[model samples]
Target: MTENRRFLLRRRPDGDPVRDDFELVSAPVPSPPPGGFVMRNHYCSIDPAMRGWMDDEPSYMPPIALDDPVRATTVGVVHASDNDDYAVGQWVMGLNAIEEYSVVTPGHFTAPVDVEAVDSPTRFLTAMGAVSLTAYFGMTDVAKPKAGETLCVTGAAGAVGSVVGQIGKIHGCRVIGIAGGAEKCRRLTEDYSFDVAIDYRGKDIEELRAEIAQAAPDGLDMVFENVGSPIMEAEVFNLATHARIVLCGLISEYNAEERVGLRNLWQLIVHQATIHGFLIADYAPRFPEGGAKIMEWVREGKLRIDEDVQEGIENSYDTFMRLFSGANEGKQILKLP
Candidate 1:
């Protein structure tokens, strides 16, 4: 454990990334520069966004440079520090990477996490982390869901999606969740208390549209879009008048070799709908407020957050692939050994 083990990007991926696209290299643990600290990353977040970061494209965040450890949100303890703001042994979470150690300077993305404030230290990466915050701000501030309105959330069984659905219910909206499998759909209705759950697995665009239309007979009032392409295309066709669409993540197209344009763009014009692309980073200043409100909901048993934690940094590739393969159970996390 003396040498820091890093899962580094060696080459850009053509499509769905393969193991050869990355290299697990052992290097000397990075030292903190002036006004910085080094953290021994204990948990690494595995998200669909990681795929987009691998591509050399203009995005909200810069693409992961070649030969560098893949960027990720990590929760770890301060192993060494050169800053008075962050002392050694303090637990912190922020934008780091999939490496044994990370050199961090306190900023908008970096913050000390009160480990005792939550049930587990990893909660900072799950329920109280960016996942829930994304759901909170996206649902409340962006989508602006209203009572009696029909709210449809794609990838509803996911970490953010699940929370979004519950928030919709709390706001008195009729929640319709579209997930991948029978189990996930069942959980959407039973575990998350969604009004209706549509299983999108094994369904074509037409079939999925039929199911969605059936679920929301009057059309959808608000759409929290996570998966893109076919799912988005279907959701667009079923928009209610003056609908608000929160464009969160396009997970489906993240690893696609060729992107397909949505055929139902005109539906938005016809419905006079508004689609707002949302990024959690935009609300960085209010993370504390959002986190507090979300934790309150969790304590009240109004929200249920799940995390799928995999062991060993060596399993990073397989763990990350779960986001694409639909193998992950919940918020995907990688626990360092």
Candidate 2:
């Protein structure tokens, strides 16, 4: 029997999660039945969404059970296969626990991965995985951004934020990104080709509003909000009439014990702005179509995908906490043994 090292939730997190909240333990890998396959995990994705999963609240996805292996998306190599569809030595992406190995019976959870075509295994966690798909559908299908319109994205240096801003550009919108620091702001504008980038760190609400106004003088036609709390409040005051705000992840409020109140909600009614909260799982059926278009843009050099890869699985807790602190420059993933 194969022995695997796995990270399990020792306790549900309050505020930001710490390494002690997770317990790394060894487990005997279960033998795959007739239809199952055994996989050796190579990399695991660490996303902001995982924080939401820790809460025992109603969400787009089910919360992870306490003491269970932490739920995550992973890229792995098939080591033993009883399922003809998944051959040994082939790479695959699946919703597996953070483990050295896993046994899975494929259904809604597993898909083949072409690692070479993707540039890196981590891309499956970022551009080609749920992150890119969220941006693709949220902007294209939900927000319906048009050319010449002004699009603003928050958490703009993150995995989903970067892709959302780029997709806005592809749709011919003047794209502006809101990031946390000078370095992230510089990368958003210089590397990702955002029309403007705002650094929100140390800035008061007035300063933030002023920078946003300067960047989008006519108001924002579309807003892809990844950070919530105070930033969302500021954006509300600057929304254009009939503006569509796609509410994706709320990184800001994740650390709060209680939900932060948005003081400017009346702005939504006054400006006729529509705020829609979405999870990528809702667009599961259309993933291929969206994924194909994103890949095409990537291949044509119209979209740039970025990733901040932590070197080892042992550092997963630190890497995950980086999302809330804005320490990660791109999609955060951990390379496993």
Candidate 3:
């Protein structure tokens, strides 16, 4: 534990990231500087957004620099502290890196989390974490689901999309989830209570659009989009008048060498719909407000969040690839030994 192991970004990726794109290195355990603290990371969050961050492009956050540990959100405990406000052994979660240890300062992304307030520290990366907050604000504030209206969710089986569909149901909206494979589609209805589940696997854009049209014959009043491009284009073909589209994430294009542009944007103009880009960082100040409400639903058995936990730093690459491969069942996490 004395040596800090880090998964460093060796180079920027061209298409899908390869193992050579990152290098695992061991360095001396770092000590906290003035007004800072050192945290021993227990779990690293594996999200699709990490792929986007690796590319040298404009984004909400800076691209991961070459030779630096890949940026990620981690839940851990204070191993050492130089800050008066943070004490050793306190549980915290923050936008850190894929390393055994992290030097942290109290700021927008680094803060103490109450372990007693939740079931487990890993839950901070799932249910009561940024994933849930993204779903909450996207539905409650942006899309604004209304009773009896149809809500179409792309990537509906994912961490954010699953929560979004459930939130839609809570508001009395009919939920239609579009996911890959039969199992994921089944889970949309049986597990998440989505009214209809459309399997987009092995289907062309028109084929997928036809299914969406059948599932939501009245046209979709709201769309919670996670996977972009073709899936989003398919959703657009079935929009109701004044439909709202929440652009949460575009996992499909994140790893593409060349990003795909939508051909169905004219549907938005025809329907007089609106598409709003959403970033969770913009809602940092209201995290407590959203987290509390999500926790309330979770405690009351109205919400369910799943986690796919893998062990060891060596498995980080494969674990992370699950986000793009559709192999992960829920919120992908890499647990540090």
Q: Best by TM-score, which number?
A: 3
Q: How accurate is candidate 2 locally (lDDT)?
A: 0.86
Alpha-carbon runs more than 4 Å astray in model 1: none
Candidate 2 lDDT, tens digit per residue, 244-311? 99999788888798887788899999899998988888787787788788889999999999888887
Count of backbone clashes, every candidate in sequence: 0, 0, 0
lDDT of 3 by residue, 1-337 (tens): 7799999999999898999999899999999989999999999999999998898889888999999998999999999999988899999899999999999988989878999988788889998788989999999999988899999998999999999999999899999999999999999999999999999888998998899899899899999999998989989999999999999988999887788867888999999999999999989899989999998998988888888999999888999899989999988999998
1 or 3: which has the higher TM-score? 3
Q: What's each prediction's TM-score?
A: 0.98, 0.96, 0.99
lDDT of 3 at 240: 94
- TM for candidate 3 is 0.99
lDDT of 1 by residue, 244-301 (tens): 9999988888887788867789999999999998999989899889999989998999
What order do candidates take by lDDT, descending? 3, 1, 2
User: lDDT for every model?
Assistant: 0.92, 0.86, 0.92
Better of 1 and 2 by TM-score: 1
The CA-based lDDT of model 3 is what? 0.92
Q: Considering only N, C-alpha and C atoms within 3 Å, which residue pairs clash in candidate 1?
A: none
